[model samples]
Every structure is written in structure tokens, then in C-alpha cells.
Target: MVEAAQQPKRRKRIAMVHPKFPPSFWSFGFIKEIGGFKTVMPPLGLATLAALTPDEYDVVIVDENVEDIDFEINADLIVLSSMAIQEERMFEVADEFRRRGYFVCMGGPICNVLPGRCRPHCDVLFEGEGEYTWKQFLTEWEKGEHADNYVQEEKVDLRDTPPPRIDLLQTSAYRVGCIQTTRGCPFNCEFCDIIVTYGRKVRAKPIENVIKELQAWADAGVDFVTIADDNLVGDRVYAKKMLKAVGDWNRARRYPLAFYVEMSVDAARDVEFLELIRHANVVETFLGIESPRSEQLKETKKFQNAATPLLDAVKIIQSYGVVIAAGMIVGFDNDDVGIFEDQYTFLQMAGIPIAMLGILQAIPRTPLYERIEKAGRLRSAAQGNNTLSVTNIEPLKMTYEELVTGYRNLFVRSYTLDAIGERWLNNVKQWGSKRDVPPFPGKKPEDPNPADEPNRKWIQKPLGRPRIHLIFATLLILKYYFAGGKEKRNFALKMMWGTLKLQPAAFMQTMNYLAYFIHLREYAEKVVARDEKFNYVFDDKNLTAESLGEDGHINMVKNERSKKTKINVNDAYDGAEVTADIAADLEAVQAR
Candidate 1:
């Protein structure tokens, strides 16, 4: 059993909650890859907060998205970090702990925007970046001068930020832990709230400081790390410097960790930037191809990504050898029925192995929110209460139901078992055909690991499968030998068979996604049910315009429906008058 200190030391207990992940059907190679959900890392914000907290405080990190918080552990303080999607559950947690006499404090993106909304449940509602604000709150709390609310000093530079307390993390639970090189994006996409939270001017930690953190992780024996920048390549000059710093550091250490990052399609313009990324041992980059249509892109003011040939761009990025995971949205104002088929065909043509098809929703404090409101399209500004199809504006071309149904159809068709199988089959075939392409120029051959050499024999190594390769090779040669011009079919079949032999585990994972498809069908039906409910109370003429106030957000509302139900004219009737009614009923029964 764990021990508690005498006098309790007024020990502060903190619990950090991560936002629920949106459903991802195509993320992990279309199957339950072995290190699949290992991508779910500890919350870096809370970890940094812990690093900043006083050493006297007892910090117990609970990542609710991955593990349960132990309520049985008696605590004097409970701190929570959350985002918009998790505000409801975060409130529930706060309420439960408050009832148990614990001081609950809240912070992160959701609380930062709507402090007054979360003020009721929390003792300290910390708005803005938690690095400085959290320390201030703790100092006051320790001195017994705690307030009902605490807002962080705005525009705190992130360069001097402390490294997160990695000792608090469950290292084995992830393929990699997260580290941020920069905060904020340069682009002003209307739908994005990143700039609102982090500001448009990007703040990057110094390359030396970033290297120190990576070195610390490597010393701790962590093998995988994600540079969790909202936009890693937003500024190519900084990206080059940072990527080179990481690559140089890793090269000295003989390349210890594999990295992943998120960036825009504009990174394609910088060839040197791409080379640095490749040299850095970056495995994957998530590209936001929000929509394929130029009109939709312009409507959303995602002009940085507009007018580009998506298939050609994807192929160009792929030729650099880094895997691409594209993000696609379907509920833009210009979207129509044809978009469903267009998106599917686009993915197929681009050779994109994974695409995230999502519905558009109005996020808080975004330019989109202001613009939509001005257009008299604010659906409900109830903030955290918004769910699927809670966008303020009507989808201009398609009805709400049509949009919802179209999204469902797109997801269904794109993630179908047969489609997934065929995609994998095609991906393997394409990659295999290009296997003869020479290794990337200027990339150093991976040096051997000295420490690994000692323990190498004890570690299970791959069994030689030369015979299997020969057998498959012979069959392929014969198939191509026989098939005249339809060698493409023969090649596809051979690759499918080779993929099964070479990566049996990955192949099985692809097959397992068939089960996820079944679950998706059930989930889609629930979304349909919710959409049907919306149809009942919809105001066709104004759509969201009728519900919102002049300021263009439903910040407040009167509960007239509840007040009306509580009062009744029939309540004044006396019991003696009611007795005559009962007597009539008895007489009727007697006659019967």
C-alpha cells in the first residue's frame, strides 16, 4: 500500500484529464497495429504544470483519457486540464471532488475561453497559459490566501518555459511521449481556434532548450518522441534550424528516437526543409487537406492551402519517403452531394492510405464564429453544450440532414472493409514497385547501437525468410511470365501475398478494422438519430439566426419552458369538489 505523510503536509493532489479522441478509422495502417494507441501520450500541459509546482506538493498524475483517477487516494487538491470537447465530464469530476471537500482548480483551452462558465464548479479557474498562472495559484493557496478565481498573465513568452515532469509519466504506455517546439500558427484559417488560444505570432522554444529536453528523454531511455507543434513547419527557417538541431543531436547519439510532427502542405515548397525533416528521422506528418474544392477552401479562408492539385501534392510529399496522414472535412458551405464521391476518388488517386473525414462545427472564439454570427448564422453559443451539427450557419447548398447523411455515406464507403483491403493492396503494390529507387541522397547509413550490441543475442531477432521470399519471387516471375499486358493485376496479387508474408501482424491489423467498420455502422446510426431530433425543432426560415441574440451568440437563455410547467390553474380546485368527480366514476363502475 502507498504511504501518506504525517500532518498530511497539506499535500496538493492533481489530476489531469485529456480530451476524448474523435473516432479515427484510418490512423493506424487500417488495422490495430501493435503500437496502435501508443500514440496517446501524457498531457504535456499538465506535465509542465507539475514541473512548475512546488516540490513540497505531492503530485499524482491521472490521465483519464488513458487511465482512471483513483478517488480512494485522499487529497487536499485536485487540478484538471481540459479542452472544449471534455468540459462536461471535467465539470462532473470537479463537482464530485468538491462534494468530497477537495479544492478543485481548472485550466487549459476550454477554461481559458470561458472562465465564468466554469467558475461555479472550480475554486480556481485559471485562464490563459498555465505555466506562470499555476505557480501563482499554488503560492496563494499555500499561504491560505486562495481566491475563487485566478487568471494567468496573458502573453507570457514560452521560450523560458520549464520542461515537463517526465518522471510522472507511464513511459511504457506510449510509443512516444509529446514535446512541443512551438505554440501557435501563422495562418488565419477561420475554422481554427489555435491562434485565438496561442496567438498568431508563433513562440518557439530555443533550439538548445529543445535539444536539452530530447537529451533528457534519451537519457531516460525513451525511444520515441513527437514534436507536438500545432504547425511544425509554419515558418520554414525556424523549422530547418530546429529539425537540424534535433537531427544533429540524434546523430551524435547515433539516432535514438523516431519522431512525428504536424505541418501544412506549404512545407512542400521548401526542398531543403523537406531534406532536414527526412534527415531528422521523422516518420509521419499529418497534413490538413481540409477540403479538396477551391471554393470551399476560400470560403473558410484556408487560402494558404487553396488552388493546389491535391493528388500531385500528395505524391510529391510521398516521394520524400515520409508517410502522410491527411485530414479532410465534409460540411463546408459549398459542399454538395458530389463531394462524397469526389473525396473518395481523391484519396484513391492521391494514394493516401489514411484520411480523417470530419463534420464541421463552430468552435469557440474563432473568426468563423464571428463571421457566421454576422451572417445571422449563430446556432447556439451555449459553448461546451454544442455537439454534432451544432454549427451556427446552414450548409448553403445542402440541407442539414443531407450534409449529415452525406458525411455518414462518405465515412461508410471510405472505411468499408473491402475498400480498406483494396487500399492496402494498392498501397503495398505502389510502394513495392518503387522499392528499387535508390536511398535518399545525403542521408547517412544508420550506425549500429553500441549498447544494443551487448544485449543483441538475448533480444529475439527476425528469423531468416529467404526461402519464403524465393517462393513468392518465383510465383511472381511465373505470373508476369504468363500474363501478357495485364501484369498490373499480377503485380497487385503478388504484393498482397508478399505483404501477408513479410508483415503478417500489420496484415492482421488491416483485417481487424472490419470489426471497427461494424462499430462505425452502429455509431453512424446514433448520429442519424440525433439528426432526426434536430429536424423536429428546426427553424427552416432562419436556421440558427432565430436562436442567437444580436451579438450573434447564444450566451444566455431564459428557462420559460420549465417555469410554465411548474404553475397550473387546476391546483386551486378544492378536494370536496374533486370528491363529486370520484363519486361519478364509482357510479359508472357500478352500472358497468
Candidate 2:
């Protein structure tokens, strides 16, 4: 017999699609009108995968949140990356492509967390971190054969990672760019899945590696970037070094880049840490002050937050001219119906402008999940996007009705025009004057609890291009005020003039909050009007992944208004529904 010949190497075309993210507070969609951008940040994971792929492969990345995907694109492989919240859209897209006979490969957090639900939807599946596993798959792909599943048993070393393909992103569609400097958080917040997925040991990319990414983003016309780490200050020593390197890198540029980061509330404790952050030109810090009540902090084992008063921590970070945003939670086991009022009062008192308040969820395989399951309170799988105001676990202290009702009202109250004006005013008024302030702040007589004292580390940074900065700020205020109703215009005058008078340096943040005033309030109104009928997804007994229907869609039922069904153990219903899905069904009916 003649010797068989080896298959020739071929450069395959790959299409990477990120599913559309459902509307939530994080959508920040008002930027479309305010800044003419549709998305907040690009999908960095898919971009990183593009960089890791061999150069011979043709790659194109599409973010559904920014633009629609071309269903019929010419591609040898259809690659998808999604979070669990985006599974429905991911499934719809995956099924459509597979129907057309393309090899659909799926990966990212969606696969890692829900393998059983996802495996059947794609021809090839990848679980765990893609940095190493992705490269392994590509090698076999080049040989014309690869396994159906690729799982990474070991975590990736940050120093070995390459810069993401930022050049492949549609930079003009996003208001801010994003990069990850670290993975893994040291805290063991019971409800958190980040630690479960990435582990407790913090791993940071080398300072030089981060600089390469920063330059890539800057070169791609990205001026404001978000450090999308779960906790940037997880390792303070590495964090300080990273911040200073960024500061030096930024200083060398004619136009410096700005950043927003998520960090532990305790980062405010170290004066040196805050200085380095300001040195790096960070404009904001998102602190996970999960609850205002100490009991809830103890309940979740979030000891770091309990180490200091959270309200004072807010004040300390704010003094550096850094905006304070927060991650807040309601529906902890320690919470009661009264918890709603308490959360509202605490937010108002702390002067934090952007609080991402969510009803706490019990994520799978976490300590909280195990505890909830053991206690028979883990009702269903988590929907993953926490700020949506619905969660999987049933409340111990309040009824389901009360939980959703209170959450809806809290959303409305938190973003009201009056509340918006007060918080921003408080934000600037509390900023400590740099030179005259004493070392120990918040002291009638030298109090050391950081949040109790005003920070004395305030420094004025140069206005790089004053005309451009002033015009952007002016346009924001004018546009928002004109677009808003009578109540908003009144609040804008008070907030804009008050911020300029109290601290001209804080004017930009004040105008930015006005955009939030429109975006968040509109989101709240849409959610509140949502027929609470969708909340019935939880009331179904023995409801599992199968209950969401064979297509993984909570497909809507076309029942008369009088025939609206409440979930029951023996209902035999095969599908669940979300409010958006219900609205789509309504549109279909009207079209018919």
C-alpha cells in the first residue's frame, strides 16, 4: 500500500460573538445619548483569546451589546464567550449557527459554571480559564482534529499572558475601555463565586505586562479605562507597585488615561495605598460595602468591612477627588423588611453616588450555596447578574413578595432626583482641604477610623486640555438638563452650581451623576412596571434547568389575562419567563 500523506495546514476563519447583556443598572446605556457610545467596556476575554490564537487564523470579534452579530458570516469555526446571565441569547445564537452546519465552540464563565446545561448546545466546549486551555485547543485545531471539551486543571501564570487584541475592538462604540491586572481575591465572602472560580491566592500580571496593555489601549484611542479586577487591592504590596508603574507610564503620555477600580473598603485604611492610586490617576473606586449593618457583614464573613466603619471609609477615599461607588446588598439572612429603609438611609449618609444594590444571590458550589441548600432555602440556580433585583435563594427574614416589593421601591428611591443632588453635594463638601488639614482626620480629637476623619491627601491635578474638558462637562450638563423633565432641570441647576461653587474640581463628577440620574431612574421605572408575574419562575416546585424549556428559553405562554397562571408543584409547565421575554411575545402577537 502507498504511504498516506499528512493533511495540509489550513488557516481557518473564526468568528467570536459575545451575547447581548440584559438591561440592568450596569448597562449605563445613557452613554449612547450622552457620549454617543453604546457600551461601557469591551469584552476583554474574547479579545485576549484573539491575541492568543495563531496568526494564520482569521479572527473577528463581535460584541452583541455594541452591534448585532452577522448570523450568516463566512467562518470555519463559530466561537462564543458568555456569562451565565447571557445563556439564553448564547443558546439562541449557538443553535442558529449549528443549524447551518458550522462547528460552534463555546467557552468562558457560562461553561465553567453550568457545564451540563451548556454542553449539549455547542459542538465543542471549553471550561475553566481560557489562557492555557485555549492555546491547547488551537494546537489540535491546526492538526484538523480537537476534543469536544478542553478543561484547564491548573491556573494561568499572569506573567506568561499576552496583551489582549484591543486593536480588534470597535473602540468608538464604547465610552470606556477595560483591562484586567489581576485575578483571584483574598476575601471569602460567602456568596461570592469569584474566589471559587479563581481561588483565594491573588495573582497579578507583572507591572511591565500591564504597561503593554495600557499602551495598547491608549494607542487604540481608549482614554478612560476600567481595571476590571474583582479586587485590584487584593494584594496591597503588588497593588502599590502596579499603581506607581501605571502612574509613571501615564505621566510619560501627553494625554493621561483615567481608571476606575474595584477594591476592598479597607484600601482606604492605608494612606500610602490611596496616594499611589491617585498617583496612577484613578478617578473612582468601587467598594463592596455589602450592607450597612454590622450583623450582615458578620453573617457573610466579610470581616474586612467590619474592620472599619464603612461610612468613614467612603469619606476617606472621596477626599482624594476619587468618586465612591459601592456594591450593596439586601436580603441577607440578617435582613428584615426594615432593611430597605436602612439601606436607603445609609447610602444617603455615606454620600456615595453610585451604589450597585442587589438582592444577594446564593451562587452554586459556594459556602453560601451549601449553607442555603442544607437549610432548604436555596430555591433555584442563580441568574448571575446580581443587580437585577431578583436572586435564587429564598429570604429567611422576609417573604418573597416582600423581598421583591422592597427591592423595587429601593431602586426607585435610591435614584430619585432629590437624592441624586444631595449625594453629589455631600461628595464635594466632605473633601478635605489638602494643606491645612491635620494628619489624623475625622477627629474632634484625632480619630483614627479612616471614614470618621476627612482625608488630608487631596491634591489638584493639572487640567491637561482645559478647553476640551470644559466643553465636555458643559455639554453634559446642558444636554441632560434639556432632556430631563421640569424636576430634573431644577435639580441640575442646584447640583451644577453647588458643585462648582464648593469645589470646581468636582464639577465633572457632578455632571456625570446627572447622566446616572436619567439612566438609573428610567431603569428603575421599567423594572417596577414589570409584571411581577415573572417572579413566578421561583414558585415552581422541582424547577430545574429543564424547567426553563428544552431550548433553555423561559419561553412565554400565550394565556389570556384571566388565565394567568401561578406556579405550582404539579403545574407540568415546561417553560419559565423573564419580563423581556414576555414583552417579546407581546410584540409577536401584535405582528400577527
Candidate 3:
């Protein structure tokens, strides 16, 4: 063994790689076409980790989303950061780097929540917040300890946390910048891992610190940002103050910034909060309106959403001119196959055009995982991209095969061109015509990056975003109309006439929704096609799996569902799922 005093004094080189995300709806794959950006939101956690890294080290960030990883780059150690969705690629990179005799360190949400799976792949693993643990590791590394793991025993304090190394980012490559103003969430939804990783108690950065980060992003030419909080309204009092400060700051700027945020649906009840959001130039809000049905809502312990009539709550927020992008899920104990049509109808009525419709998943470290594991009901590991109907937990009410069929149908029915167009145009009419509509969230107003921004002249306009470069608009209109068949021309005409007739300012937003159609429809089709290999079809009109009873013609899968087995939604301790009763449900499925 080498002596500790014999270590080289030379500056260490660290290669920090942010893993590539799998194809998912949330990735906004359409950004590359219209915005010329590689991704929507940048990886905030990795960037923050780089800040925690010591000054003497030469840290180079390689975001796989913007550019491919250069394995030959100079480095003494390799650091990989990833979310649960990026775990597969994270491990592959880790194992490769280790094979080449490099010490690989892994952290971020993937490692924090699923350390067991990640531990074997990485030489050094970090769990929970890296703020304190990373510094501890750095101290030990300099002393040549070569420790295998470092974990933060206690939650981090945001006040003392250093600003992320934003200077290290290749900022221009991303369409929407991201900054986390808070850590942790208040609610305890059983299947969710947000509270699992960050915990239920919320921690927030100071207002001044947030503005400092905003100004840093502004300097880097990013004016449109997404507040990457698990739930921004987790602490209503703190959120209100931060919103006011941000709104004031944005309004004072030469070119105001636009923002998007995620919060619980109950935020609609707080008109003061909505006012703050509007003044803050927040153009969009993603609400976890997981299900339209009250039973499903209560079942997940997502009490905030269950407290309100979802459709009315969605409309209340939209009336403030902030468009709502919703999260919808299927396969609850209370859910039968009929949730497909139920959710689709609810989304249309609520005019929530953008949705991340996914199936219920038992993520690692969550209550769902423990219960399902105990019941011997887990089918496969959850890869964290729920959009493709992948889930580890077999539901208490439906067979895995039948669940997948309804899931596939939900995507097709929800994303059908006609369905999306109707919702899109209707939403534009409701909010777009009121002149209260927020500016289209995009690049900085004055100077958008030419190479990355598509149709720059049209999208960079200040305030209401009323001006569209007619020449460029004409080209896009012609390209869509004549490029394909009947649907193409109709959508093309709809894009042009819809925006122009309803609200001129809504042109960019109109184009955005149209691009979503181009992406979501094809994506849905591909996911459905991949699932077709199992050879099962369930009628979209069927109310439940039993309704297709002994039908030789309608339902291909004869998976039985049990009404007898269910865990009390209130039994969800804190934020963890308590689905011990689901064993009976799965046993019933096995019997069929």
C-alpha cells in the first residue's frame, strides 16, 4: 500500500458526466426542431455538485444531452450524476470508466434512492444530499483514504449551500434553464419518491440567493427558466415571498424573464399565490392532478388534489392566464380499465393540452416497493420512465397485461391529432383571447441564440409575443400543409388560422402545441407498437376488465380483478405506500 504522505501534489482532474435521459414525454423532444436546443431543462443537481467540488481540482462537465461523452478526455477520476430515469446509462458509463482503472463516484437522486443497485457499479457512492457528504469525501480523498461510500446523515441547510457552478454549463444548448429554489415536498403520496429522497420537510434557498442565481442565468443568456422544485407551494408562506421577489426582479429587468413551475393543484385555492405567479411572469404550471376520480386521489394519499374538484381547480388556475400541464396516472387499486376514457374526458374538459400520462409505478425506497416486494407481486424493476407503460407493481384491480392495454390506449386516445387540436385551440381561445395570456416561454427576449433558436425573429419579441415573422410563418405553414396528407394540411391551416383568428400573440404558443402533436402522436404510436408484441387488446369503451366477461371477441386477456383486496389510503404512513392488502389482489389475478 502507498503511504498517505507519498500522494502527488499535482492538481486532480475530475470528469463530471451528466447521463443521457431516455426518450420520455417530459424531455420535450420537440425542442430540437423549433428551438434548436438539445434539451429543455439542464441537470441542476450535477451542476450543483460541481460547486461542492474543491477549487484546486480541474472539473469539466460533460452533459450528454448537449454532446456525446469524450472518453479520451483528461481525467484522474470520473463522476457520474443521474436521475432514476438515467440510471441504466449511468451504470453503463460507471462500469466502463472503472474497467479503464478510473475511480468512479456516483451521486444524485438515482444513487440516493437506489444505492443498492448503484453501489456495485461505482467505486464511491453518495446518498442523500451531497452538500456535506461530498466535502467530507474530498477531505478524505486528499488524505488518500480511498473510501467506498459517503452518505449525508442529516438534511442539508439551503442557506449555507454554495451557489452551483453555473459557469461550468454549456448554457446555450438547453432551451429552458432550471434552478431549484426549494428541496423536499409537504404531501405524502404513497407511490412517489420525491419525499423519499428529499424528505417531507421543505427547505428553501434565500430570496437573495435565488435572484443571484437568476442573474447568473441571465448573464448566460437564459431568460426562460423552470423552477425545478418537487412542489413549489409546499410551504405557501415561503413560496409567496419568493414569487414576489422574483416578479419584482423580472419586471425591473430590461427584458423580463418568463418561468414555469410545478406545484400541487390546491395552489389554485390561494388567489394570492396565483396573483404572485401571474406577476412573476410564470407562463405555465405543472399540477400533479394524478387522477380525475376521487377514490384514486385518496388512494394515493395525494390529499391536496382530492380536496378540490379537479376540473374546476384546473380552470381556476388557467383563468390567471397560466396554461396547465398535468400529470395523470393509471392502475390504482380503485382504478379499473375505464380510467383511460375518464382521464381523457377530464383533460379535454379542463383544457389541459399538455399532459404526462403514465402508469402507477412502485419506485425503489417508496412504500409501494416494500409492500409489493412482500406480496411477491413485483414483475420487473421500474426504470423510472413511466410513459411507456412500464411498471414493477401488478395492480390489485387489473392484470398486468390488461393494465398495459388500457395504458397504450390512453396514450393513443389522448394524443390523437383531432383530440389534441381541439384541446389546443379551445385553450388558446379561453386564455389566449383574454390578453392576460403570459408570454410564450422561450429564450431571452432581446437576443436569442441564433443557431439554437428556430425562427428567432418571430419568437424573441418582448411582452405579449404578438409579432411573428410572416415570411417564416408562411414557410412553416407551407411545409406542414404540403409535406404530407389530409391531416397535415388541416393541422397546418389550423395552426395559421387558429392563432391569427383567436389571439395574434398566441402564435408561438400555437406553434409549440403543434410541435407537441408532431412529437406526442408519433411517440404514442411507437410505444403502443412496442407493446403490441404481447398480443392483447381491450376495448376502449369497456368500463372494467370484468365487463368484457367471457367475451371471445372483445377482450383478448382474461385476467381477473379482485374487488375484495385493497389497502386503506389513510394507511399510507407519512409518504410511503402501505399496500399490504394487495397480495390478495394479485392472488386473484393469478387464479384467473
As a whole number from 0 to 100, the lDDT of residue 293 in candidate 3 is: 79
| Local error of candidate 2 at residue 532 (angstroms) | 4.8
Give the Å shift of residue 137 in candidate 1: 1.5
For residues 159-271, what per-residue lDDT tens digits would candidate 1 score against the true structure?
A: 75988888887665554567998888998888887888788778888888898888777766565677889999776778899988887777566566667689988776677
TM-score of each: 0.72, 0.83, 0.83
Question: Quick one: best lDDT, which candidate?
Answer: 2
Total colliding residue pairs, candidate 1 = 3
Lowest lDDT 10-residue stretch of candidate 3: 535-544
1-592 per-residue lDDT for model 3 (tens digits): 8666876779989989998877767776743544456886787877888888878999889999888988777898888988877876787888888887888899988777778878889889988888888888888888898579988878889986777888888887887678889999988999888888888999999989999988888778776788989899998999999998987777567435778899999887798887788667777889999887777888888888777756556666776667789999998878886666667656765568888888887887888778788899876667457776556667887677677777766677777677787667656655532234553334344543222222223332322212353344435535754687888778767766876786676665666566556667767665443532222111112122222223312322222322433322233212322133432322232343
Q: Report every candidate's CA lDDT.
A: 0.59, 0.72, 0.71
The residue ranges of model 2 lying beyond 4 angstroms of the native Cα positions read 1-9, 434-480, 528-592
lDDT of 3: 0.71
Pairs that clash in candidate 3: none
User: Which residue pairs come into collision in candidate 2?
Assistant: 312-451, 313-451, 441-453, 442-453, 554-576
Better of 1 and 3 by lDDT: 3
Please, what are the lDDT tens digits per residue for candidate 2 over residues 1-592? 9989989877689999998876667887654556556777799999999989889899999899888988889899999998866777898999999998999999988787667778888998998888888888888877978899998768889887788998888887887788999999999999888887788999989888899888887777666789999998888899999998887677556325778899999887799888777667777788899887778888999988866656556767876767788998999998887777667766776678888888888766689989998999877657656665467888988887667667766767777778777777777765644311212111122233322334433323312223465477458657767676788788888998997788765555566667666777776666432523223221224433212223322212222321443222111111212234323422332232
Evaluate model 1: give its lDDT: 0.59
